[model samples]
Target: MAAATVLEVPGGPDGVREVRVSSPERLMWPADGITKLDLAEYFIAVADPFLRAVGGRPVTLQRFPEGIEGEEFYNKNPPKGLPEWARTVMCTYPSGRRHHQLVIDEVATAIWAAQMNTVTFHPWPVRAEQPDNPDELRIDLDPQPGRTFTDAVEAAYALREVLGELGLTAWPKTSGNRGVHVYARVSPTHEFLDVRHGVIGVARELERRLPDLVTTAWWKEERGERVFVDFNQACRDRTIASAYSPRPLAGAPVSTPVTWDELRDVDPRELTIRTVADLVRQRGDAWEGIDDPAHVGDVANAIALWDKDVHERGLGELNFPPDYPKMPGEPPRVQPSKRRKDREDGDYLAPKAERDAAWGLPVIPPVSPMLAKPVKAIPEGDYLYEPKWDGFRSIVFRSGDTVEIGSRNEKPMTRYFPEVVEAVRASLPEKCVVDGEIVVIGPTGDRLDFELLQQRIHPAASRVRKLSVETPAHFVAFDLLALGDDDLTERPFGERRALLEEALEGVEAPIHLTRATDDPAVAKEWFHQFEGAGLDGIIAKPRDLTYQPDRRVMLKVKHERTADCVVAGYRTHKSGDDAIGSVLLGLYTADGTLMSVGVIGAFPMARRRELFEELQPLVTTFDDHPWAWAEQEAGTRTPRSSEQSRWAAGKDLSFTPLRPERVVEVRYDHMEGVRFRHTAQFVRWRPDRDPESCTYEQLEEPVSFDLADVLGADR
Candidate 1:
């Protein structure tokens, strides 16, 4: 097949062997010895599809260590199996002993070959430093292309001032990658959430000071040109790519630490693995003595000193990353991830008056102007078929003169689209209740950003005011889910939709009429065309299908396929056994713990063989492993006894049983779950992912059963 990529090796294990790919196509998992720069390039190339899915967020790939320390982490588990050539790099030293130093050396070699010069050292985050003490504060900044490093440096200084005002000391370090990291030494008394809050406080202050150029939105899709103050990285187990390591891309790995002064003259793209080592050797490690003990609480107290009035500054109100679920009272940032703003003002309030005048008359429900009646037989063979929008599903209830609007969850969503409430109020004849969806042509026209519409969910009174001015959505009256004192939920969708349209008339803003068609050919064509328009997949409501909240009566088609995987073991070399080099996958059994399922040998060239040799000892005979199990029916092998089983009966084997505690979630296209249908790429470990929670349930059918049923069925 003339290998599909330039780096494909044939007839081998999943990631261990690579083959040539089409010019634009890169291999998924590669053999070990791939440098960080290469790894980065690989990710950049391969992950482009995933990147676009997240709206072009810049991503960085990080590698874990080969081992943690003296304990043989995954000798029997074989973190990930690598080819013999890659494993040879971890040759035994004169002492006849191997150490992680070899893995480090291998990574260093690959880094140089990849032409990467920068390396940021990111150790596991420990509880330390507050945001106040100037000495304890540290900042990591990565300057994007087209932006000046001074912008981040200036942001750091501004953040320091803000944190200092709150009562803390801040320390600054070059991330060795493209960014500079600012750390605030604070009392370790706070949990990750508290520290994040404190950090968010500092970030918000910076955003306020530089509103024209900065933002604290953690979701990449939501942030436009603003600098992102990423406090979410403060979560446990989160790590930034460190200095001098090789990446997965062909020539884009290798991060180098630098002095703040160097940032002024350096371009982030210049920091590749190939150049960082020489640069470090020539310049010596700057800030080498940066390990001095310092206090952390000094900075946190500084934030406490801020005036109550600053709360109005709205400094720390940005969104958090989706990976870490929000804490209570956290903004509803995950519901829909885009921010909306409107430029026109005069027309914003005009619709309310018109709807008010139509109050006594029937109000028009929001509908899919795109759909008409369904045809049992074929008409135009290539026509588009769409489901009729069942009018705006609005739920309104007023308290005195003030009216609060909400969606299915009873969340207060009137703020972002203040105009919707006014229209609703005008259309109602009495001090009554009503429910519908607000539909209008967005400023962008044609397509709708439902995510933008979702921004209306807010609890704060002031946030409501700002949102009203920033993004004013329109009202598209549809089904009256609740009308006056009656709950119409029990009614069929058609009946409710009918009552909705009959109830609202001349209520301004062209009322969208929800309609459906039975033309299968048109339906398929419409599905393809409207996908890019951001409409979630079409629903196959059997004209008879009623409204069922959170039910699968409606089928949805997403743009991609994603799944979660568990981290069963990591590969270590004969040398470096402290830092994990590469990872292995583990699938869960009915009993809960994960068994090593598959391996990903594609690593940056520098860490390849070291990772292989370091992990080789973790291997054991397939027959005797504790976690290893053979599916008697399928003839497939899996892990048994989640604990590391060093001896089978009385015979000593090379492998050891781990605590079976850690679980990770990975995104891949294919899955056997019993083992990866193919090698799985490494994603972040799930500190958020629980090992006991990793069950065989994700493999169940989405259309047929409830999640509870799936889990219970497994039981």
Candidate 2:
């Protein structure tokens, strides 16, 4: 290989930038036998178009000094002797530290970058003048495992449609490897947060439309074989390889921006430095009008799409990159598998059940009652107060290694909650049936996400297993239903409570049996505290009362929590075919994504007649209704079905997906996982409140009292 060579390249309007290349004979593209000098010439040829996309933007170069086959390093700051006119912008990093990053302002800068052995050009989407507000929205379509470039191409088209809906045009490009890059020019008025939100709104919309093929999950484990919409690239200080930059792969492929018309058949790998300028010369620049000042459109239109997503639909801000400050309402940042640390003290990680211990708690299901007046139940003598877990009332049966989770209606639910089954097996005795509420907790264990727990009920075993691994349901055992062969149901509540304590000796989380006391003062504090933390009121079980199956014997002291929910649709009353049976309730997630929380139906005859009269005018046909995908998204993380008919296997599920217009305030005691534990009570129609204000965040209650202290079973 020759040591060095001097090359004079035409520099667009800048006249010329005489660049000296070292080791000009060193093969950068061994496959095509293209050398270092060939790269310098390619950069000069594509300088105009490449500068149009990345010039004036702070850039980081992926430098391969020796060649693509040699060692590489990222060049963030410009070299010591940058050209006189070359600029740099101070950019902040994850450490809150800032550095002056290089800005390729002209064609000469492009050649200089090439001379540094930069195989790729990573440019910020924002110009140097306003680095905080990006004028362009970029989406990186990264193909993950089982996904290919074809998948990314398909995603780009879908993204195009989404962008068009927001009155924006997306320019498609190949990432010069396996991925695709799509960018839309936006007005620079809004800050980085606004642009990032717009990108998330588009990504989430795409994820919804093409869930099987697209993913916006920042967590790597959650993103399966799908095209990841890398919205984080829109964030401030983030950058991507600019058009015409060569990739560091075996083939020196360029990150070539293509016209939308040619996106279908274009192969990314073939667009190398050798061929990029030729294609550009033939088609002119695919981005000729890209950087024109007149072409810059108001980014507000796209921001409005985000507003419509979060403010109206309730899909709030999506997760930010971990290096960012803890964003408001962002889900916990911890990895799903590493969450064991949050609840590790107990038997959560036990390898297997202790079969030699006493097994099978033989007890009948306990009955519960509505005590909208818990204050009245405290003085009723020998009553224990426990927070009503906002989860499904279940009786978990465990024998040896086998565990069965029974729903309140006596249906088999073990399949839907495998982790809970494993938890039951690990914590409880060999043979025991413990009464509990199956709840889903967040990564930090600070809050209960009833909606997340509901996602466990997928028909497919694979999906259920997937969810089990992702969002495992927890069992909050409040009552000891049975103990070994010794039947505890027939025993008094106080005696059964004692046996329950003994049976759950080494039991831990997912099997936490909250200790009860006869003190009325502590009961009052717990009732209010638990309810504040989003838990359903307090449980007050009389000591002398026996377990009563299918009877409301145990007293539940819960304040009737009320929220104004949008009546997205109504189901006919099962009893009388004459009137509307129930109103389907929906709440907005943080990003303004509308989701069905539950339904309310038990209306008086007069109220039912009045509601039917009121709903008739607003009722809409289910065809293409926005809420048509209601049950699919509302019920589980895994798509059970495209419609409601698939929710319950044999239930007569039918309802019209209506326009979301009317809002109603309903009173309900608990949210069992996703949907309301029971039907919500209609308080009255809200004439003043907008349906959008009925956000689910209003229902979140802060977590209190460590489980270890609650159970007195701390490890």
Candidate 3:
């Protein structure tokens, strides 16, 4: 093979132009042994349809100097060696910067690009003459995790149906990967934003039809096992791989255009650069009539559909790409988990320093929740009594639009419960630090479900957002730590409670001021009746005492019950010694299936060693145990390890299974769903009780009561 060669490319100014191809034998697809000269020849073979698709558009070059496996870069600026016959067009980017880009006017220009090692060509949807208005609406169907190319194909077909309803003809092509790209030629009467809205409208319609198979969620975390309709591809400066453009993959696959009839069965891997030229020759271009005047569709109908969605359905503008400037009517750019943190750092909220100074607190945030000591009965004194909320202890700080939920250990939890933040912003004072409990109502809408509440504190922003809507949290404000510049921490409990009640007056559900009374008889009655509503117990606070952090200035009275559970397993102590740390307990359901209830682990060091020795004979393999499913489905969901503690990251959670023969009585406060809310204390060995008889029927069920009643009316 020669080092260089000259090829005569047709459709130039003078009918034909000679373009020099350098390194003729240099491999472009090394695996296939296809050379650079082969690429130039391939362009010549598919020149007519290729020119019709990208000739008058500003094209971006994806080049690899070596081969497909080597380092690659995107080329927007025209390369150094410019032929006089070729031309450049000035285009504006999303950043509002104008620059000249290469325009493929002839087959010689494509051949020259091949000589410069261009493998893929990304063409703008607009013509070079009209850069602001788009002539095509492009949508990229991307299959997220747990989805496949078939899902994208199904979404594309539905998208075609949607476009057809809008009087537009749809064109389908493989994305050269595990996705599909659909295009519709429209009259250049709409600007880029309007065209993007049209695409969004079509995509939303497709999603509405195939809700299970398609999604238009901009966040990847929220698009669960579905084909994501990527409407952003139609935005300004965004482009998709042109039809007949080769992708830099192992097999050198091309983004080949295909008819809707063949798209369902076509294999993208088979449409490689080495075979695409012949395929184009045999079937011709599937989009040959794409540029015909009769084929051009009006975007007015699609834009009207979008307007209907905005006006009637409230389905407004979706999220834009991060690189673009903040768009009007666009949602917040931050993901769900970081939304509150971003607000704290952004100028949208009042500065923390300003809020602190205005609140007159030495430390505005991380106000330690006042501790409580266990009491046997309602204390007789000048005290205020309220039902104890069984949820996460949090101190909420809000100023303007910013709301920060601080955990018991002083960690920022603002990202986890977005609903509570929004509720606080709507109902609470403009600036205050309120002490409250973040709780979630159970599926029955009756009691507080601590398990569901725990599910809201997830790391993935997408999961947090989904759970926020599905299982929204509520804020039960108990005390006011700070009100405006008046630091209420030094104020007596009576004054602070009165101020908190006044501040939270007229608040609504999901944000309420806890009910309190000065009557001891009412407090005693509430302590007995409120447990049915999933409240932990009654908290009696001394009216004369000031706010004290980590001090037991208040008294808590909770109900304690005993349950006989099956001794199922045991985990070793963290000290790496031969001692048992926790004893896993289980109870039989009505269907005779053993379920893990909780663990008991408050034994002394000597007793731990003794228990380890006593339980060694009962040890059994997981294969022979009822909780073996925990090992089989480790990450998805395991009963034993479902709730992970942040402080115990990387801690060994595995335990030795035991024979379900031994029964032990343990003391617990209450139930959180089916499991115990906290660690149970060992009462005694129930040698007289049968493990099979120890079922959920033996447990007491609380009477149903609405959570809204517990939160009381608006006042």
Candidate 4:
């Protein structure tokens, strides 16, 4: 091959132009042995359809100087050595910057791009002339964790139906990755934000129709195993890979457009730079009439759906990309966990001076509630035992009318439980700090309802107020940490207990001092008896133990029972190598639904590897598994599983699906809602226990008792 060659490209001012292709023998797809000249030739072959898709649009060139394996950069600015025949369009960015970008007007322009090592073409949804108003509404169907390309295809079909209802003709194309991209031609009557809202409206409707199979969650943690309808792709400056554009991947796959009927059977891998040109020649462009005036959709119709979403459904704007400026009506830019943390920290709720002033006492906010360590039995000798409250650990700070509830993590719980704050102001000492648990009673008022208590932690002040009245939380003060200006943290437990009881004597219904017993026999009796009232366990504090923040100075004893559970899946250890990190356990509900009970972790490295090998034969796909909703990769973590907690947010949640034929016995403390209160301890494999027999019925249920009795309501 020659070092360079000149080819006559059609569609020039003079009918044809000679474009010099330097390094024609240099490989563009090294693995596939495709040379730069081959790329230029491919563009020439598919020129008609390629120009229809990207012609007269501001196009970005994704270039790789070496082959696909080397470094790459996106070229928006017109590069050096620009030919006078090649045209450029001035484009405005979200950051208020403007620059002239290359426009792919003809075959010669595309050939020139190929000569510059351009592997992919990303074109704006608008024409070069009307750069501010988009003529096409594009939706990117992305498959989230536990989902696959097939899921995105399903979502795309559903989306097509949604667009059809709005009188828009939809076109489908492979993303050249593991997703799909759908587009609809619309009248350029609306600006970028309006078009973005239209896309959001359509996506939200698609999610509503196929709630199980699709999602519109902006955050990855909340998406689960569904195809995510990416509404933000229609925003200003965002673009998708133009049809017939080659992707910078192994084998040089192309983002090829396909007819609705052909989509189901089309194999994206088969449509590549080496083959797409011929495929386009054989069948013609699926979007042949996309730009026809008769086929153009009314932008007003799609915007109408957006109006309905806002006015009738109360659905509002979604989060924009992080790089964009904060948009109105959009939710907090941070992830849910971080947003909750910010709310808990009072960072979002109030100014620092205001929050500081709200804590009217000497003990400021963020007083870490003393923690407890678990013990097998209630310890003897100089110990005071109290019923362990199954609620949020909180520190109540009150100077007078103002009160602030501090969480164990030193965040504000004051806003979440407004009822508790009012109660503390009304009943507790004028200036005092008390460590307690914020709990909500069940409907029957017999047991504590942790679920309802969790519902109190809402970001919306209106919702919080509504829930506070509907599901009022009570503060059960257990220890006195301050009185007036006195800091009682250094005071002994015995002294604190006396002071706490004295301080809360004759307090109102919502506020009460925790009952304590010095006798071990009574403490043991209360441990089993209080479990029925949804009390967590028993906490025993030494008489001389001072109030130590975040320290496990107290001992706790809780009920523990073993049950055979189905081992549905296993997450790989963070260290990788397919080592078993934890096994997800499930139990059959009364309705035959397999409920995720919890997980069993904390295995030795040797046992982890051994279990990985042991479970290999039983590994299965999500297709037929009962927990098919949980799609996961073997030995890898996923966002679906990482949503469990803030600490576990970075941990791998993806697990290899098991056949649910194996049953293992696990020792659990108790149930919190449907799952275990803490990580269950592995007992032994129950080969004799049938997986179908592993139902919630087998677990021990404590007798119901009035929580008021535990709090000495009658006294």
Give a tens-digit lDDT track for model 3, residues 370-421: 7788888888789999889999999998877867898887788899998888
**In candidate 1, what are the lDDT values of residues 213-304, reduced to their tens digit?**
67766555656655567766654434454334333343444444456567456665565444554565577654443344543445445344
Candidate 3 steric clashes: 0
Report the lDDT tens digits of candidate 2 across residue range 1-715: 4557777766545676576776677677677687877887888788788878887889988888667776888877565456666677766543333446788877767777777777788988888898777889899999998999999999999999988887777888899889999988988888888888878888888999999999988888999889999989988767888877888776778888898889999988789877888999898999888777665667787777778887888877666665565556766556677766556333332211122122333432222311222343455577766677777778877777977777876677888987887877678887776777887776656566666776777789999989988887777776665566765655687887788777777766656766566887877777666543456667788888666444445667666668788888776765465577877888887887777678887865556767777778787775545465454556532112433555566665567666788888898766654556677888888889888888887885434644334434342
Full-model lDDT for every candidate: 0.43, 0.73, 0.84, 0.84
RMSD of each: 25.9, 30.2, 23.8, 23.1
TM-score of model number 3: 0.49
Q: Sorted by TM-score, highest first, which candidate order results? A: 3, 4, 2, 1
Model 3, CA-based lDDT: 0.84
Off by over 4 Å in 3: 1-363, 630-647, 713-715
> Residue 359 deviation, candidate 1, in Å?
47
Instruction: Looking at model 4, report the run of 10 residues with the lowest lDDT sum.
Output: 631-640
Sort every candidate by lDDT, greatest first: 4, 3, 2, 1
| lDDT against true structure, model 4 | 0.84
Candidate closer to the true structure by TM-score (higher is better), 1 or 2? 2
Give model 2's clash tally: 33
Clashes of 4: 1
Q: Give each model a TM-score.
A: 0.32, 0.47, 0.49, 0.49
Could you tell me which 10 consecutive residues in candidate 2 have the lowest summed lDDT? 349-358
